[model samples]
Target: MCYQLVERFSACRCLYFQHAVDPCEAYRQRGHSVQEKVVLVGYTCSRHSMRWSGNKARDSTLSDSGYSSIKG
Candidate 1:
């Protein structure tokens, strides 16, 4: 329900931001034990109108892991 004209930045590290714009609640997709856990994380830049995701096992969120947001 967020109608704010948000701006997206390449360096911006915000996952909940995607949820603000998208209909489906975008959450950190987590993995399982045997194959190692994976958290689906991404960033959205409204100003640039660009959305990018670090779909790698290493790319983790601030809340998910100790590392910072993925910047690429």
Candidate 2:
């Protein structure tokens, strides 16, 4: 039996990558005969992935510096 490797997106389960094996003629005779070994990537596909907004504010405080004034 011949086996093929398939990589898919973890989130959407979309086809990301594939490695095909040189299957024998007997295997090709039957439709969809190649055995698929599915390997899920850690990240999602670009189309289904999330994007972070650059315009969002990091902090609401007026001071950007880490240190604050210590009043006695």
Best by lDDT: 2
Give each model's whole-structure lDDT: 0.34, 0.63
Candidate 2, 14-63: lDDT as tens digits:
89778878576677565657788887764556565545469653432232
Best by TM-score: 2
lDDT of 2: 0.63
List the candidate 1 regions with Cα displacement exceeding 4 Å: 1-4, 7-57, 64-72
lDDT of 1 by residue, 1-70 (tens): 2122332332454334332333223333353112222333333334333335666333233233233445
What is residue 25's positional error in candidate 2, in angstroms?
8.2
Point out where model 2 deviates above 4 Å: 22-32, 51-72
